[model samples]
Target: MVALSFISLVGCEASVATHPVSGKVVLADGSPVGGGIIKFRTKSDEGETVKAHGQIQPDGSFQLTTFQDGDGALEGEHEAILFSPATGDGHNAVAAPNFPTKYRKYETSGLKFQVGPGENDFVIQLGTR
Candidate 1:
């Protein structure tokens, strides 16, 4: 049973090494974004793509996880993106608080980060323009 379970887990994801990544999201004025989801995506040297993300705390802090909680992301250049929470349910839903719309898309967001060996820390500050 242990072997079977291990195989199942291995089948789900390739055994790629991930480094610890944690950070805070703040506005230009140094205020926390408050609430949202932040994602980091990158392609491995072997052409495999890995993604990691974490829920933003009320203080804007976050810790990334690729497979397990706080396991982090692969070592490489990562494209970043943020998704604000919805204000209402269903059709009346609106984006959380206020953040630039560009942040919703990785390409236009102009957000990038480098993940290296060991623990990685960052402070993502949102720009006004």
Candidate 2:
């Protein structure tokens, strides 16, 4: 049938297939960091653009869902990027409501990681560059 053929064709392609990515973002002080960007990048063994994107969450928690056929992300060397709540683009962001105003030290620059297929638990500890 056409539906079966379409599914077969989709399975033949290599892409970020269906999967789930879950993790937590925190500061070096073991405190939760809220409101920032998290970027995931993967490079194939053949130097191909595997996958890349920036996911943002108000809290230090995230879950990336990959779909079937078109959602299975390639497994390989991966990197991550995390922005802090205290500093953004050198503008010197203010402290979060959970912390004191003087404690403006939760923002982070770029984070890195290695990703594979399956559930992944991550903790991002942001430090000054």
Candidate 3:
């Protein structure tokens, strides 16, 4: 009974609020990235790091989801990372030829964005270098 009560309490506690984030991933020449994964990572005021990610659409558009589908991410400064590898095996395979590998890691990606209240939209450009 005690364990059940604890679980119920935990479930009842509200989750961190998230704002809607949408964006488009493009290249320096203004061409859409087509297929890839884009992530937005940031640390909350409480020092807990949170992340939101989305699959880059054929049109390079994406909608971030942190906790739930289309729920978005926490508002704050975020580092962006976009990576698309050549065709492989599985549902995670993304066909992004000529995509730079440096953008795969956040530390070397050199991409950043600031999320605000309400709807936060962006257009991220990745370089071939």
Candidate 4:
């Protein structure tokens, strides 16, 4: 399973060779927009599409499985997008919590990422008005 612990600002460390990339999605008020999908895709040396993707947690966190041994898209630049369908008036997480169907996965294409091997920090700012 994937690890989901928060990183400390002090001097803790991770020893795995495989790197991790993390980011945050928030609204104009600086509140997090949680629970959706995040995907990263790139072409391999053989020209085949290599995709590493996962879902954002309820608190707006996400982790995608990158290949070990420094051989994946997490080592370089990538693309990103956020898709949440409800307007959040009365249909959002606090009221409904879970969507009736699926997370809106293709509603926005304005997100992009240039991730590094160990840790790439990103903050996505959005508005509801």
Q: Which candidate achieves the best TM-score against the true structure?
A: 1
Tens-digit lDDT track of model 3 for 32-57: 87777789999977797789999888
- Native RMSD of candidate 4 (Å): 10.4
lDDT of 1 by residue, 66-113 (tens): 998999999999999898766687888754546678988888889899
Q: Give the runs in model 3 whose Cα sits over 4 Å from its true position.
A: 1-13, 85-94
Local lDDT at 100 for model 4: 23
The order of the candidates by lDDT, greatest first, is 1, 3, 4, 2
Pairs clashing within candidate 4: none
Model 2 C-alpha lDDT per residue in residues 4-91, reported as the tens digit of each score: 9988866755343434556776667876666654556565565655444334455767665333422434565555554434454557
Ranked by TM-score, top first: 1, 3, 4, 2
Q: Which residues of candidate 2, in runs, are more than 4 Å off? A: 1-19, 65-73, 83-110
Cα TM-score per model:
0.81, 0.54, 0.80, 0.57
Consecutive 10-residue window with the lowest summed lDDT within model 4: 9-18
Badly placed stretches (over 4 Å) of model 1 are: 1-14, 86-95
Cα displacement (angstroms), candidate 1, residue 69, comes to: 0.6
CA RMSD of each candidate after superposition: 3.7, 8.7, 3.6, 10.4
Q: After superposition, how far is residue 82 of candidate 3 from its true place, in Å?
A: 1.0
Estimate, for each residue in 7-124, the C-alpha lDDT of model 4 and write its tens digit: 4311122322234766666677887777765667654445655556655676766666655422324355556554543545555534222322322332345566666656666776
